[model samples]
Target: MTRLLEILISLAIVAVLFTVVGFILPSSRHLEHSVETNRKMPIVFDTLNSVRRFKDWNPSVAGDPNIKLNLSGPESGVGAKISWDSEEKALGQGSWTISKSEPGKLIAYAIEDVDRGHDKSSEFTFTPTGKGGRNIQITQAYDVNYGMNLLGRYSGLYVTSNIGEKMKLGLASLSNMLATIPNLDYTVLGKDDPALAPKLADRAGENLLVLNAAVPLNQITIQTQMKTNIEWIKKNIAANGLEAVGPVRIITNEYGSSIYSFDVAQQVRKAGTDATVKLEGLKLANNVELLYNEPGKTAVVAFKGHMSNLQNVRDALRAWAMTRGYETIDRPYEAWKNGIDPGFAPGQEGEYDVVWAIK
Candidate 1:
């Protein structure tokens, strides 16, 4: 009886010590992780916001397939919810509901990990590279709320490393998934403020098949001019039996008297040294010319939409360069990207990278 009484007293003392220790432990934790990806901002934002695709990139869900999820509400955006029930200890039972959303900028969620029936919150921010406009900085932050209990505080202490690893894996999965999609679109991913963007870099030299045209800017719009140039190049590329490799590049040879000189060109796969012009439609017969673009320092900004929206992009780039003590030289140009589709139509948006030569 004395021995039994002594053992019971010892266990009670140890429990008391644990309760005291809880007072010194932190009551909450915050974990943040970030990754850089070449995937466009809209695609990344849309993918991350969809609860139905959670298992594809979410670490906790991916770890345990036995977890059954009940995704209810709208397909995406605010009000979407994904609740899970799992026998596996790792997954447990939980739910996530979208609390806030900003299409291409941010998405915030309220997380309820019901394994212990508590609530937390998470946020994701998609910012431009500050260097490369073609890429984005994807960041996720977790604000963990630990209950005011001895056991809760103890568990929070061990969560940091495990959560970080999962975040890294989840980001990798997201990058891979976006890369596999056939045709992805790009919208402006950075802040409208250009002062925070990166410095202009050097552009490389390239040989191109160009169709130069000087048109009265007042008589026609930028869209009409670019479309006419693009159609001509497409026909010429087809006639030559060659494939265009990259964006359709345009160089403004001169800008005066409301007249703009445009050299619309494409870098194509060749048979040997060069390609001979053979296009015979739209009054462009025997008008094909080849030009080798000299490499120079340039700044790039992504424009998402029609060519008419190009002035805004040019203005932004000029502002960014002026703040950095740079001057525009020669003229600006654009390289059409395979943004949504390789083709265009009325009101259809696409990604076009505007390049400006600077000194």
Candidate 2:
């Protein structure tokens, strides 16, 4: 009994000395992990911007099902924040808010403890890599100050192994997420105009339930007509007790200053004859008709603000396609992944992905 007691005392003293020594260690630590992805910077930026998808790839949320999580503000970019609380000690409780956003370049976040205020800093930087900016170098980093707490300071020893491993895992998940995305690149025309960047992507055909609208080959009211078609599609889909599966797509073959033709449609799950949303003055093209986006090469660009400004982007895309060997197989289309809000003033920003099918 006496020998056991001595051994226990010695062990306790050793722990005390270890913690005491930890006090002299640096209280601040910075770690970074990087991964190369074949996806373009915009897709990587978009993926990281969407915090709603974090539960799928984030290491912290990977295993925990009981965490109390509250997501507030915008789902992506500035003002986005996610607070999570857990009974697990390693998980603890805290909130992270995007503090700064420089689109396509960097995104920074500040972490705050639920009870103690400011906690740490984390960020992701996207650097263009590979040929013609077709690839991206994704760097995720964290800067943490352990303070004077011995246990906290001692935790610094594991930052490289623990936090770094998590970053690596997260990056791997991100790479996998982007792997199947069509190979795309960009030729930035101006820093002030991301929409005019002349981007390109490789896309595969998808099953769609679209509402087709045929209009005059040359009409200045195309934007207005586009919205009209969207409203019809939405109302009819809701009328059918169904929901659109994805973004609204515009289909067309002819477009010029003097001539234009188009089809405005919404993507939907493919189903049999009975499953259809019939819109007034429009046909629910129940067939998987013009869904093929050639086996490779498509033109894409950022479209925002007034849909009218999209004309400039389309012109730029045509110029880009002409410069390359690509030929336009269809009319320009906008994928409205996020709902369209046509009320924004000029120069104000929004998210709308435009694709032009080419063979």
Candidate 3:
């Protein structure tokens, strides 16, 4: 009787010890799953990188149809930021910052949740494969101090799977959506070296006519023309809910009814504000050109202020072209800063686009 009782008591103590050890010992709860989806890498990466676009793929956006999102920095490139306040634990108060981005290739970001632990980072890679398709691979990693490591692991896995699955689906859907839109080849002007323009002209047996579209020309009474263009631009700006900059000068090559010059920049300023458009860190100076160099096509449209948003302008233009059934044949031209300081008056950036028949 004594031995039996001792044995039972010893077993009970051993069981308790084992139970305690199991609870205290560090363990990880992790889960990860992936699905292959079809989507262009650029579109996927761009959508993920921009908070404005993230809504299309975020599965955690629930119960807060009106969550306020504050945007800072550029719209889509590196150094973009989005701060959001959400009630959902999966997307509690946090901001997504672009840590690194390689256009159409890879993007990595860090998620800082004010309510959740410290920080978590995720990386997404886009790989092009055979059969005219692209595969997006997403990997999420979590790191935390010992005790919370378990929770971190589980959260990371769940969030990653959930978000990754949505991303895949969104990307797939986006691909389908984009496919429905006709694949139009954007007009990118072949690089005609400023240095080679003379040579090309010589070979073509033509005058060495350099088209300068930057500054306003000394000739031409363009007050009415400028007003007309500015008014047109203002309407477009309002339509897109973007601010307007100018009815600024436009470039036109003309001397008494015979077009000799192609500088449209001066044409815009004649009737509009004198201050030039401002852009910081724009490496490439450009000469703006019209899509169809035809007669009576002079017009101006205000591209919203974010210089980084030139793509939006391009995308908008592409859509416009599609609607008009016009084919773009030349690379879009731009004027390097018209020697204007953007700081003088913010939101005054505008462009004057003009075209003339080549006789």
Candidate 4:
């Protein structure tokens, strides 16, 4: 009887120790990882704000090649969500929804994982660093609430080795992906009006009268050359019984500091016919050529400025396309919206739809 009493006493002591240790453990977990890059704030913020490019930079996707992803809600900012299903036991099924977004500042996501059940959240905070804020530091933080779940509190002990490590890997992958995008800031293109933002568009195939010109980069010289080319295009349109159907397009070949070489083109159609009908017989000048541009996808942005600033706009447009994983397939061109009448004089404003063909 004495031995039996001793065994019961030992069991009571063990239960007490287990309960005390469980209650003593913290009921919450917080983990953070940070990475710094020279990439601008806009680029980093935009990347985190949207889930469209999530697979590209997400380290978890690389672990499971057959993982299926479904995206819902708006395209970006708050309300965007991405859910994943994987055959791998570690991944199982989970969903991430954007809970909050502050432009150039912070992005927070509500994370749900079926395998790991706990109220979890993750956020990315941006801070400008380096001299003159040329570089940005991105901090990815994670939080989980265990509450009264002792089992969850025990799991929290390994959170650093598991969730913490994933955050580190993710941040590194994000920095690498940011490096692939062009560094030029495209947001400036739409500073005054949102409509001027770079957008995906389609260009219809059309017959064009193209005149190639190479002249000194002087504003007066370039204007004179454009005038001569436009006159030739007009005469060809008249001689061939065709009508000018659209604004003039200038396809930039090269814009060197000393010389500017470009192709001056005008879309044309047979007289009294829509642009859909192909011109069968057209007279072309010796210096001009007839070329057909095929219909394709393009990134377009509107600009009202002098011609000298067009290069920067083009670069910005290309950068925007690159951020979306689009590849430039053809040389960029400009559709002069107000016609080519405005001479290339200083302070002369010209309206144009800058275009870059992409796929």
Which candidate's TM-score is highest? 4
Q: Candidates sorted by lDDT, descending order?
A: 4, 1, 2, 3
What is candidate 4's CA lDDT for residue 304?
A: 90
Pairs that collide, model 1:
none
Candidate 4 error regions (>4 Å): 1-23, 211-221, 256-261, 277-296, 324-328, 341-343
Q: What tens digits encode model 4's per-residue C-alpha lDDT throughout 1-359?
A: 99999999999998888778879988998988999989877788888888877888766555788999999998789999989999988888888899999998899999888534377999999999999999999999999998888778878888899888888888888999898777878999998899788999987888889999999988888878888899998999888888888789899999998999999999899888778665666768758888887888999999998888899889889878766657787789999988665636565789999999998
What's the true lDDT of residue 173 in model 1? 83
TM-score of each: 0.50, 0.51, 0.42, 0.82
Q: What is the C-alpha lDDT of each candidate?
A: 0.69, 0.66, 0.42, 0.86
For model 4, the run of ten residues with the poorest summed lDDT: 339-348
Once model 1 is optimally superposed onto the true structure by TM-score, how far is the C-alpha of residue 156 displaced, in angstroms? 0.5
Cα lDDT tens digits, model 3, 1-359, are 99999999999998888667645644443223333434445444545556554544444344478776777777666677778887765567777777888876767766676423454555556665546564555433333222444444334445445545655565554454444333422222112333211011111111111224322332232333333444554443344333423223333333233322333332211123332332122121222221212222211123324333343444444433322223344334233234223312356653322221111
Ranking by TM-score: 4, 2, 1, 3
Which residue segments of model 2 deviate by more than 4 Å?
Answer: 1-16, 66-68, 86-89, 112-118, 183-359
**Candidate 2 lDDT tens digits, 1-359:** 99999999999999989887887877888888899987656567766775655665677665567998888888578888888888877778777788888988898988775222126888999988888876789889888876776777777877788878887898888787566444433344335776456666776444444555556543346656767777766665654554566667766555556555667777553334322333223233333232323245687776655555555566556545533435566567777555544423355554567777776
lDDT of 1: 0.69
Worst 10 residues of 2 by lDDT: 273-282
Residue 243, candidate 2: Cα error in Å is 24
Candidate 3 local accuracy as lDDT? 0.42
Residue 318 in candidate 3, Cα distance off native in Å: 3.5
